[model samples]
Target: MKTFSMSPAAGERYVPVSCPVCGESRTREGWNCGSYRFARCIGCGHLYQNPQPHFDGLRARYGDDYFSYELENDANFFDLMLKGLQDAGFFELERKLGDRRRFLDIGCATGMLLAYLKNRDWRVQGVEICEPAARYGVEKRKVPIAVGTLDEAAFQDAAFSFVHFSHVIEHVPDPRAFLLEVNRVLEPGGYVITVTPNRAGLQARVFRERWRSSIADHLNLFSRRSLVRLLSECGFSPIGWKTWGGIAKGMAPNFVKAPLDRLAKLAGFGDVVLVVSQKISRKPQDPPVGPPDGAP
Candidate 1:
């Protein structure tokens, strides 16, 4: 549960950015963390870090410290991922996929999830930004992992039947582009599961600027509505949505946390959300349509 500080390096370039989802420049000032500021997009209710660090600088944050953090928490993270997928009824979908079970994990740290899936008869591939983490997964875990960005990997078209990324899209410099790359690599009718913190959840409303996910490393903070919109725009149709993490560990007593967790799952509001979607067909060269409403 250690959050990355991601302190900006000296002379690192920072630039203002429009909302990645709705493509709007108008935003309301949001939480002010120590070194970074968030902005709520007026067009689509998307929260993102504005005047963000350059992509290269941001990518450089995942080094030795990040590797250690992922290594320490890999098992816990893998368990959570399994629970999330199970809650989303992913096993049924996996069965439906039959022998066409080519899977890809983006930003896969140490490849624990991929390893597990591989053992379950999946042909798995992984992309990791941190070199050490990728090396460890490849050498120790005996999993196939490429050390670089997804775009840099240049995978073949329609390469996978299942694509997964947990808590990774929020760190992307351009989520739309990242997703398009996903779309390009995903086979028709393939499934994609995205997991990220929910800015509109109860914890965020209560904690405001003090929310655990309001960290410098998270460039985008997505709500359910914003995320659905983004997924639709990126050629995915959401089939199921699941959320968990009502109260963070140690934040409240077990009695209080237990009920809150139940309520979070029942009411569709939680600290984190997992969206399961299927890729829809779209012309590769077609431009992304604008937001639904014309208010912009």
Candidate 2:
């Protein structure tokens, strides 16, 4: 739960940019946390960290301790993650995609989730950005992990039946390309489950500029509408959607958690969103008809 502070080095890495998901320029209303700025896109109504740390900046910031910070350097990290995955979103994927074929975890980090999936008879593979984190997964957790970015890994086309990631897409420099890569590796009718902090969630509304999810490292903060739109554009058709519930934790005393959550989730205002989508056919369209080759 420890948030990364925007250091002088990280700040130096910042270069002002526009919205990645939407090509439109950033709106005037935005908040500055230290020197970093989070802006909303006028076109898509999405919030993102403009002037975010580039790939090199991200690499410099993560270094060695980032994994330790993420793992909490705790012995029970895998155990804790297993329980949470089952209780949270894993079962939903399982129930939908009954047969477990090939599974790939993008930005798997220490491979806790991938390891758990392996236990369920899945042929699991992971791609991690940080070397230390990838090594930890391969060495200690006994998970098969590739050390590099998604584009660098070069997985085979239609190689995986299920591809998953939590809170990782927001960190990518180009989510559109990232998802297209994901679609490339995923088999036809494959399932993809993605989770990210929701910018249009209750907490974001309540906190406004002070929302915790609008942190330094998180580059894209998506709402359900924007996220689902991204998925459709990337060739994934959403089958199910649910917000990672925090209404019970963060709701005020006057608010009733259950009823509020039912309504809030439908309205796409949850702290996090768990989206289950199936990869649709992305084949090239046939050439337009004019006349026969000899006739025209």
Candidate 3:
């Protein structure tokens, strides 16, 4: 594994939070990529950053230039096609719902997905952690974006019919708690769609920690098995899921963009994973009624 130095200023501070999945205390490990501080949970083998940077800090790290870079140089055409693929997932969700329904997108960076769904007449709302990106989405794209973390947002429970969180779960401090919140906001039988980098993929094995997905922002590293387990524990029943190599993964590094980069598909090393799950309403367990009288 390639090792990187830790910045003295960045490495000096971090707050401790219990493991999101196992509820275990996390101990500091070291600095990763000279940018992110790392902590590992001995109970669940889940790694995270202690006292991770806030949303504002993350926004500073990924400025407006980053989106432009993605739009202009980094796999631009391929990403558009990937959007179509993501829409296909949304379409499947529509079929499952049997009606036009509201959709909530977490980490909706530039509102591309929200815009796409809006065009299809689905009620679209988004929660974004990056203030600049959220502002840009509202000002430039006219998207209905809420700027902040989901926990801080004032959305009512059981409001949304569908929710999508693409590549955002790994960045969360508490995956279990986050999913519980997702369940609370989603109506019974509402679908949750997620796409993440597959830690069990061949590229992960070949590249190990050097895999591009293992960047500074990524805290939790989850294999497909682990992700499935986590979701099950969080009260979601798996609808369908799959693993496939994405074209952009291969063409992203080279400025030479393609409609669909075939290197990973051809070599079979691309590391994209898809999961679809549904929220099941748990039967309300009533609290025992206290004795009417003052009898002890």
Judging by lDDT against the true structure, name the best candidate.
Answer: 1
Ranking of all predicted structures according to TM-score, beginning with the best and ending with the worst: 1, 2, 3
TM-score of 2: 0.82
Candidate 2: count of backbone clashes, pairs at least 3 residues apart or interchain: 0
Q: What's the TM-score of every candidate structure?
A: 0.94, 0.82, 0.75
Q: Candidate 3: minimum summed lDDT over ten consecutive residues — where?
A: 287-296
Per-candidate local distance difference test: 0.87, 0.73, 0.65
> Which tens-of-lDDT digit does each residue in 85-128 have in candidate 1?
89999899999999999999999999998899999999999999
> Candidate 3's residue-wise lDDT over 192-240, tens digit each?
8877777666665556556666676665766555566677677677777
Residue 13 miss distance in model 2 (angstroms): 2.8
Pitting candidate 1 against candidate 3, the one with the higher lDDT is 1
- Winner on lDDT (1 vs 2): 1
